[model samples]
Target: MTFSKPYATREALEQTIAHHAWLNEHAGSLRLPAIRTVRADGIDFASIEGRHARFTDAPAVATVLGRAHAAAWKGDLHRALLTTAHPLAHGHELPDFVSPRIAALRRHRAAGLVNAHQMTAAQSLLAASPATPVAFYKDTNLRNVLITADGPVMVDLGDLTLAPFGYDLAKLLVTLAMTYGPLPPATFTTSLACYNQPLLGAGLPPVTIGRFLGHAELHHLLTLPYLGKSGYRHPWPTVRPRPEDLT
Candidate 1:
């Protein structure tokens, strides 16, 4: 199987390793494995053996991934709240391709299209939300998670960078939609239920959580254009966008 381009920095590798270490250290609380970095080809790699979490024959692997992702997002959110003096201080850079809401609306009108325009507009809304705090993930997807007997272990951390809090959830949702087809409404609701509880517990306002989800969704939709062009294969099935799905 092909892997995406290797993670470029030692710092990225270390951050991922640290996340695993944290998970392991709090295994009783988090129930994830402690993974260590292994050096090879001048790049750092890590592994969580197959024996750790078993989803091989599980029909609900997707659901498992969904919950794991929700849990992880909560963990990250909690950490962001506790350790950082300024919640929004986490440095998440907006990608250059993201169009502002006005521009997106214009693009929508000019093209008479909806999906792209709507996606862009949503992104703009996310950017404008003051309550949304950003955090970084090296790689945020189900593929990077290993299912061992112990639990799920997040493995890759190469592309880690801070972004809006719910960005990972959006990415995961989009991936699931793409991979498994348009998500059942139940999936989205269930995942959100898991995701929202923690944010509320962390004293985050509901609107902030909504903004984060919007950002995540927008980020996923906008990034769809460039997915397969990179060495990384698209994780979900590609479908022509319906006119309604567009802006």
Candidate 2:
């Protein structure tokens, strides 16, 4: 993929290489594009093995996430990644990536990036809960998912980390919501239940869906300025979320 701005640090690139290497060997049923080659500037992704799909394709998104949620859901892979102390695994807590972004927003508020109100709201949301850790494929969002004839494929391993249970699901839901307005109440609730199934089956505590949604919202709010008016279906924060909207 091409990017106008560089997307990786040396350290993150190394971790991504390692993670993909691991996936190449171990991702049995998880669909991933083959890493064709790696060079100084970037890695090459192989041509789509099936039909190229759009991020807006809802069915495709669900199918891919289901594959990930079930096939690699919290068990051996979680322990294996932890055992190796994988650099991509931000152990047992949500990474502190948000704090630095908030700081940057404050510093650039004069540039109209984020206002004081948004910053304060973000801080409060950050304090809402001590997120319970679960196996989070942090980059499992609409932008990174692809639907192929074989099934669904997820791409971008750079941000995989151990984060709050459903963090990855929340990110996907939030990404879709931001792009297409709030999901229907039934859809939101069903999605939450589906994401919590594996954890519950494993006798882990169920995710607090609201808290996960809140955290996901904060993540997208912090991301707004960078979007530079991409014409999303809804403007966030000002959208005044409804309880049913997240149910």
lDDT of each: 0.44, 0.56
lDDT of 2 at 115: 73
The TM-score between candidate 2 and the true structure equals 0.69
What's the TM-score of every candidate structure? 0.53, 0.69
Give per-candidate clash totals: 16, 0
Which tens-of-lDDT digit does each residue in 108-128 have in candidate 2?
576786678877777676442
Task: Report how far off residue 207 is in candidate 2 (Å).
Answer: 2.0
Q: Where's the lowest-lDDT run of ten residues in candidate 1?
A: 51-60
- Residue 58 displacement (Å), model 2: 5.0
